[model samples]
Target chain A: MAGKQLFIVTGATGGFGSAILRQINLLYGEDAVIIACGRNKPKLDDVTKGFAAGVKHISVDFAERQGLKERCQAIFDLAAGETFSAAYLYNNHGLASDVTRLAQDFDDSAEIEDYFFLNLTSFQVLTAVFLKNFSGVPHTCVNISSKCAVVAFPSMSLYCTGKAARLMLYKCLAAENPEVKVLNYSPGLMLTTMTENFHNTVAVDSTKKTFQAFKEGNLYVDTDESAKKMLGIVKEGSFTSGEQIDFHDC
Target chain B: MAGKQLFIVTGATGGFGSAILRQINLLYGEDAVIIACGRNKPKLDDVTKGFAAGVKHISVDFAERQGLKERCQAIFDLAAGETFSAAYLYNNHGLASDVTRLAQDFDDSAEIEDYFFLNLTSFQVLTAVFLKNFSGVPHTCVNISSKCAVVAFPSMSLYCTGKAARLMLYKCLAAENPEVKVLNYSPGLMLTTMTENFHNTVAVDSTKKTFQAFKEGNLYVDTDESAKKMLGIVKEGSFTSGEQIDFHDC
Candidate 1:
């Protein structure tokens, strides 16, 4: 058996997931296998190619509940039936949108429901699947929550509610299953594709200007730095099973 | 202006809501206007009949976002036009269900979405509407959370997640709006209609047995006792604005 660790990263094509996968490969050498997962196959492939040869790509639309159980089972089967030494079930995938615009012009329930599905329900289904399949002790589940989870910002009601709900879900699950090391991580104010899109689409010029000011220096951190900090936390195992860790401190 | 205080109670037909409303009416007298809000108008009327003529009934479907907002606005308009003294906004509405069973047996996402709407989104929307519209200063927002909000319970995932999310929402809102006194309260286990239904329909005997033990003096407090304790806390006003008060302590 290979002594190297296996990491399953969801939203691998996304900013934080991509950065974390790259950093893990850099740190652990070529022996690490990264099961990079996302709904978009082409993007997943594009992101995985830069990684070492052992890094494999998997495409699964977790939002679609149909056949999700079987699909996850297949992934577990493909992992050679070996329990992962460590897994970063990073729920980095989310709907990037301008909440101010939505708040102004579109307060539709359907739109809110769509964001909730992508951001919250998918996380719930994935957590249930992983908890059932992986009984490995010392397993870590790292959820990528936003600052919105802690504070309610105006205009981003959908994103705020979804992220907040997901954080609570993980907290409850972590409390229930004390054996699993569940971390509710707030990757504070990363100037990634998501935040860039949010900035571009912001309706108010003042709000946009404020975001730009923050993006220039104080409010943003690169994905690589976030990933390094998070991985360091995991390595140290300093947190209790259900503790929340923010990126600013990480 | 009447010397009595005004109270707004959501889910007024529910056990805890009714109990709290009764206690408030007894303490404050017939001049107090208790706005009983719920979908079941007839039940609310029946419950509040003997209490006071000042009691008003507002039939509201909590899951209907637009309808809820409109109803809340109407209530605020009525209260403002009357120039009531102090106001207490008690968020007592919620739905508790066996989430594991629902997830396994039910395929309808609409059902799950409706559950969240009633239990989570309604709290957010209602609180926002009340805070925005009501001019009553030194206003109190009392949120009735659950023990499951703090501790994870099997089969009650929906309730757990909803209450937990709302608790955090109240916390966030309290932090932002320091002028408003927000109370996140857990009434502990109560022998409500919801619990009775839970005991009746639970698939597992162990769950039913545990609930029976809880119901028969093991894990629950009397609704009247819990309400009295909560009212005492409200009267004292010793707790900080963002503090959470669990009635189990009383």
Candidate 2:
């Protein structure tokens, strides 16, 4: 019998995260073992309830720095001794910056450290553990990057910095490991809770105007649609591994 | 008489930092109050001693998270009650990554956190405090950025990520504040202590080969030459605000 595919998705309860999960189930059906990770147990359970493939929910708060490595290892332990044809890690977890504040307003070291620990450090550690644990498996790593990764947005310094770091991290990963398939996918402007907060709290006039246009013009990409496109790109696997492929571009 | 030109340079003991200090002295002479910051007391003293400009040394360790804001404030406090026609901050302090490690090798959360605390968080906080403390002054913020900020190099993930984040932070700062001048300058591959370490310890062959070529060909940039070009760009102020001007681009 052919081996089952392994799929690990973080932020599995968020809008794009859940959409990616649903699409994974649809695409792979019973041929995959899907490990869904999120902080809220109830939400995670809801997200993984009806998948055709085997689903395992792992509750994790990325903000909690202690025991993070062990937690990441435990994620791989879920499929211990089970052989897989391929393994995929969807690094979709991230947080939005405080849109009310500009870069100059972030003077507190502790606050800035906390923000990076959750967004950049945790993200890197998780990907590292995943790659180490699945060293022998054919691996595909996807970073849910954003337009902010390449461009600056007023009042979104933290978010843009995090995304840019994440994108560069994946690019380095791709360059170092030729056998690994790495994709930095900017899902475009999706209408999620994060965007809602950005629209409401963004202090800069120019940024607020862009969000307003996105809202009024209904230009926000549907989460499921964007997720599907990302998966399609993944399935095709023709992209240059380190290159960033955005939703609008493809 | 017109006010003095206030110049603040961090990592003042390092190759590029010292070059910048010398250039400022050459350009502004006694018209500049040059604040030189570094961790080593003797090195700071050596760098600032005998400069044509009025020089002040502030010993600071960016890695120490405690009392960071106060230290940043102390930087601006050195020029208290003194007027200036223009203010310039050369944010040159940064550490190169452990080149023996790849992106996947950075799984330890605490270790990763420590790296960013020194590189990104401290960088942002210093810039923030500088902007806030010198709000009324005509401020120019220079991020001593690198080619790694825009491209990923194997075995240099942490350094690349930090540079990328810093670049994005400055870009956001420029976007949010039109009145404040921000420059991300990529001083090309300079013969410095950091490059020496990179050459000796880099694990990736392709990256190591590039460093080898630079060494054998004597292609490394002179720190003073690059610093002068950067200062020339700053003096001209013709480049678009927030634009990344590379040493080679000019």
Candidate 3:
């Protein structure tokens, strides 16, 4: 039996992630089978609340790094002895450093590890598990890359480094596995909770400029529209494996 | 005083790192005070033994992941109440994963973390400390990058990802601090303990080909030559900040 067309959305509760999931739900309705993975219960519940059907919320904290191995195993073991196809895995979850300014970058290793944990380590662990469990399946993993991946800003050093690692990791995975497609999808500037949180918490001068841009609606894209465009790109099947596509490109 | 003209080299016992150190010793003698940092006391001793007068060996294991903060503190504390200028920091320490094949990739997170720890984490920690302690000093930090940083290969996923992170981290640092120039110097392919260890330990088909190339001298530059060329690039004052200069380019 062909197992359900599963679409795994990490950071499902986040603004961009939920937007993507909402669109997927609209597109697929009862046919939608999404594994909405996130940390917070209320936020996860909120994201999946409007879904008509085929939504499963699994609360897994990438930061704490608990239950990841068991979770991935359970994800695949349930599809044991069946032809299961994971259509897509969206590595949408990301965390910017609490210490945003480069000058004031963390001397503490634990604090710095937080950025690597969320951005690079967690994504890599998940991707490795995905590849191991579903090598036969043809699927695409869209990494929600950022401007930091390509350009290094004044204060966003941690973000840039992590996203850069994510992008290169995608490229390596793409080269290794022909069946699995990897796209480093830099979403440009979007008004997301994560981005909002950066400006709210850090209050760096550069982040202040970002806040201004958001207020002016001059720098960032509409989150919903950008999500729609991303999905549209996926649906169109135009992206080559291992290619980096920006929101404007879409 | 010129503050002893300190040049700290991590992975001092390693081929590339030692080569760089040896060249510095030959060029500057007492003028260039080299701090050869590595894990092995004997190897570090061997590397710096023949040096005439300006060599200090500091043993700090990256795998230990302990006392680094204190060690770094002690390093700069020696320069307290004295005028000092750090000329260069060679972040040359590196570690390769044992699992060479992507199909046989590490299931254990610790193994994966090890690859990242030695390659990216330790480097970043030291760099952060370096920049913090010596922000006023003009210095260059050369990361001993690999072809893996730019090009992806089968079974080298862990290395590629970690090195890519290192490259981008360097870029971020260069952008943030004008005095601290960061170079992701991909030495192309080099005959080093790490590269030799890859094929020697894990005999995958892909790595076997690399081994064959190394045996026949078909691919890779000699490690010593590459080191000299890298030093030459620094000496020439041609490199722009945040530049990725390979040995071939130099």
Candidate 4:
């Protein structure tokens, strides 16, 4: 009980996110205190029911800008008065941009601001509070980044931009703090609802064709496999701090 | 004057923006229609006062969310019913981040949102409207980028994150629209008020020392010279679309 491990996973009820939770439960079992965060309360509750570890679910809508700080603070407060041997934060929550529109079609300031508020701002706030709260513990921070973070995809202007911004933010965080271990993990294109929506709705022909090929060839990565690989990387801890590690690279 | 050039420069009152304006004025002279945008009306008027070209000043506060689309639309409306041999958008406006704090210190949602509104959101909006309005013309869009876009610096998280996002945004734009010439120009460390603020207020010692060396060794690039090189790059039409051309790379 004194050497308990802590894990906080955002977007924990989603397909890839749930895989991560399962991987943690498999790896750490009763030694872990898993805090799973998702917007849907019933879904979150359902997802954590099978885990062997003590799992706590927090209903958090990252899109809502009001009381965001307080919300983040509440997340950290869950571990109050308890000392962990190690803490892990998997920053896995983000929404895909409106893919039906081209890059130049985004002329509305309010729309762009709203997109970033959920993707980047709330993400940053959560990470900051996590780091502050777990200052004494050896913490590992993972940004569930994407291949689009480094490569440009047509009709994914907002998603690419947000990912790139997030990667840089984590890089800066790593540079500023040498104590914490940071990893920008680009989980390969997995067969998730998000990817399904992207395949169906992307406006550009070239981009659509690429996704079409992936689907036809059945080349999309398995969510559970990719999640397990990421967990393996974390266990090995060979990645350079602040570097982006893609799924295929392993 | 039938094949006259159109040049739109934002942050026109600032040091680098003014230099770009002067370079365009020198290159095109009376054959250019220049739209200079900045928040300070008097300063904008003063900056364009000496230009030999036909210059128009638009007072815009990119930070303000209210009516931002209308403001960007107003910029393009100035070039309505006008045809040009080549139209250039010097997306040269951006503010430095608050360097007095570390990357993990930015926990407030509104503060982060406000910073990006000025640095990235308005920048994207302005570029989108510019490209849409000038669709018929041979358009060249330049995002006045920084080395920070690719490299993370301590105590400069917001600036680096914003630049990285903007760069990826332009990359997507270039991919989506191959007809438009796109360039991400990283104007090297220049002697400007922005640099002065950064050099003075940066919280990290390593970052502060690097700037100190630049200041002590007189290693900062001249704003006018760097601006001219960027213009020359535009004239040469040599860089790969969406690639970042740094100051020393030439």
Candidate 5:
């Protein structure tokens, strides 16, 4: 048990994040221990309680600098420990733009900063920290991306551009480091807070229509289904590093 | 003429930026006014001195937010003025990462933040500003990218990821707005300050080897050559919006 299988999850309180945690537990059972990270401690605790292998809840605000660095250090220390395991990191935290339209009178600069920080910068930092600190256990990372990375849409500039950066980051990591396996997975349109809460997220008419369509079942995938599909990719061991597996394709 | 042709350029002090400015002047002469923007006031003035139409040198630090916002607003105000021409905003500003390896002892957070700010945020802010303030004259944005955007690289993570964001941003812009012509051009190993200043820039062995190869005439295109090739793209008018034009291919 020296090198146990440990799965590290960010955004563990979110729909897809929790689903992925559940799936990992279901598949690996007692073999997998989860390090579930999120801002909401109570929520993360609630979500991980039922899992058999159990979860180590890490309460860290990714948006805050000190907290993020501390959390990252903790994770690195864990990875470098004697009892540490082969790690699988799922970078699942992200949010859509504050406004659907760029022309909005609100703080566009702040929005852009937030989007890049949350989606690209933090991920980059964490990846760097992880890769630099890895001792011997096998490592893999899955970056939760969107189809917006492939097809940039109107009113989706911030999300589109940020997700695009995320995909490229994963690609670069996989290409540069052969030892680490990485995946940029677009789980399709999920019925998560990012999609369903768009009524509160953006005020523009164009995006509102799109969100309406999502609600009306014109398009969207359930989180659990995609989570299972993603695991299927891992099970086959056929996913190459830097593979971008879309939900529809799976 | 109340509404003539004005080419807006960022990083007006750099090699490719200056070359493109000179090329535009050489081709269009008095017919094209250059809104040359850069940090160095004296350099910008010196560069634009001989041009007939003259350059509106906007000395603004891109990495600094307050100055950037003020300068951007000023540029928009100038563009909206009756004297301003049918504007063409050329986003030519980009910085190679300060170091080659991302896993350095130096501040990775600060490095990532600076790269995103200078390369992506400023470009994005300017684009949003430009598009939102447009008054119906032909406008095209040429973003100076690199082959790194297409190919991910080790030690070039910051540039690679940022340029990837830039390319995707152009794609999104072209997709969303049919009227705005956008080109993401990879200059293909230009012999610019970005290339020649590598010894002073990065301390990694891999990058040093690549730079040494560049120094040995094993690689790198001349700025003037790439500039001429790029102008050919603009003159040909066959290049589609959102098209990625590479120097060798062109």
Candidate 6:
């Protein structure tokens, strides 16, 4: 039990993050140490309580740029100086639906800047911190992207831009840093809090119907199914370090 | 002559924007007014002076969020209640060459955010401003993207992410706004200021050699040739709105 692998999952309070954590616990047994990170401590505790004592919860707001590296370093230090066999740095934190609405309403540059900072900057900071501190070979950084990253949907401009930038960032990091296994996971349209608003506000009936189909599993995926597929891909590990692994295929 | 069409060209001092301005002047005669926009007022003046009195220069930093929409609205107002027939919003403005170095040395979140704002948000703002105000049909918005938008490159994360976002933004806008002509131009591997920096700093001697060959017309494209081909494409207007036009075929 002492020598088992360690996994780090960000946004652990979210639907996708919780699903992934559940899958890992189920597959890897109670020996595996799962570091569940989220901004909400109560939510984190609730999520991790069911899991074995091996699960440790860490809470840190990535948007607070002051001493982010130091905070990440402290997290690494608490891990008993053990380098992970594989680290899953899931940068899954995202904005509420109203932010997308704000981005769509204004052509103002300042508002756009704020959106970029919130959605895009946090991903960059977390990635850099993980890469610098985590000395794990064949380390996996699974960036949670969306269908918005590939196909652009109306009224989700802020979400679309941020997700798209993260996709490109992963690609760049893959090309630059060949050692780290970088995967862009497009967990195709789920019924998360993010999608609920998307369902409510989309003007076109066809678009809403399509999102409904996706949510109802008539289209493709949910958090649990997507997480299972993603875990399968991680276990397979046949892909190159910087390859984009779409969960739908698995 | 008084009723001739109006066009707005952002980053009007640089390579692609300047060339596009020159070609438009040649095609539309002295009646066509080109509103040259950039942060560099002196350079804008120098670039537009040789053209007919129809050319007007405006200095505005699109990166600044405060009052950007108003400032852009003023530019449109200068057309004397005449909306643009087409707006070539080419923001060829880039950051310092030490961007990758800074991202690596310092924290990249803020800098990456800035890059996204400059490259992606500026385009969005300009497009929104022009589309909302202008009533003309067949109104064109040509976004100058790079090869990096499609293919990931090392040490150019900012450029790559920003360009990718720009490309997708145009795609989304094209899908949503069928009335507006949105074109994504991937001027593949041009001998631009951005490329020159990559050749100098990076250890990739082969890339530098290839760039040199390109400049010497040994590889594939020179600036003039690329510009001429792009101008022909723009003039033909054969491409569907939101079509991604790569220079490799041109």
lDDT of 4 by residue, B138-228 (tens): 8899999999999999999999999999999999999998899999999999989999999999999999999999999999999989999
Q: Residue by residue across A95-200, what tens digits does model 4's lDDT show?
A: 9899999888998998999999999999999998888886678989999999999999999999999999999999999999898889999999998989999999
What TM-score does each model's chain B reach against the true chain B?
0.88, 0.97, 0.89, 0.96, 0.89, 0.84
The DockQ-based CAPRI class assigned to model 1 is incorrect
Off by over 4 Å in 6: A65-67, A71-75, A96-104, A215-220, B83-88, B96-106, B136-138, B203-217
Per-prediction TM-score, please? 0.77, 0.98, 0.91, 0.98, 0.90, 0.90
lDDT of 5: 0.75
lDDT of 3 by residue, A52-139 (tens): 7577777767765666666666655544564554467888987766534673365666666666776777787777776666556677
* Model 4 misplaced stretches (Cα beyond 4 Å): none
Instruction: For model 1, give the interface RMSD.
Output: 4.8
Q: Which pairs of residues clash in candidate 6, taking residues 3 or more apart in a chain or in different chains? A: none
lDDT of 6 by residue, A1-250 (tens): 2356777777788788888888888777666778777778887777666776377777867666566667665555556576555566766776743433422255877666666766777777767777766554456788888777877776566677778877987887777666777888887777777677778777545567777777676664678888888877777877765556676655
List iRMS (one decimal) for every candidate: 4.8, 0.6, 2.2, 0.6, 3.0, 2.8
Among residues 3 or more apart in sequence or in different chains, the pairs in candidate 4 whose N, CA or C atoms overlap within 3 Å are none
Cα lDDT, all candidates: 0.69, 0.91, 0.73, 0.90, 0.75, 0.69
| Residue B129 error, candidate 4, Å | 0.8
Where is model 4 chain A poorest over a 10-residue stretch in terms of lDDT?
A: A39-48
- Please, what are the lDDT tens digits per residue for candidate 6 over residues B1-250? 1356677777777766676677777676676778877667777677666776388778877777677788777777777666445545444544533433422333555556666666777777877777666565356777777787777666666677887888777777776667666778876665556567676775334435556676687564566566667767877878877767888876
Q: Is candidate 1 or candidate 4 better by TM-score?
A: 4
* Per-model fnat list: 0.11, 0.95, 0.44, 0.88, 0.39, 0.52
Which is the better candidate, 2 or 3, if ranked by DockQ? 2
C-alpha positional error of residue A31 in candidate 5 after TM-score superposition, expressed in Å: 0.8
Sort order, DockQ high to low:
2, 4, 6, 3, 5, 1
DockQ of all candidates, in order?
0.20, 0.92, 0.51, 0.90, 0.46, 0.53
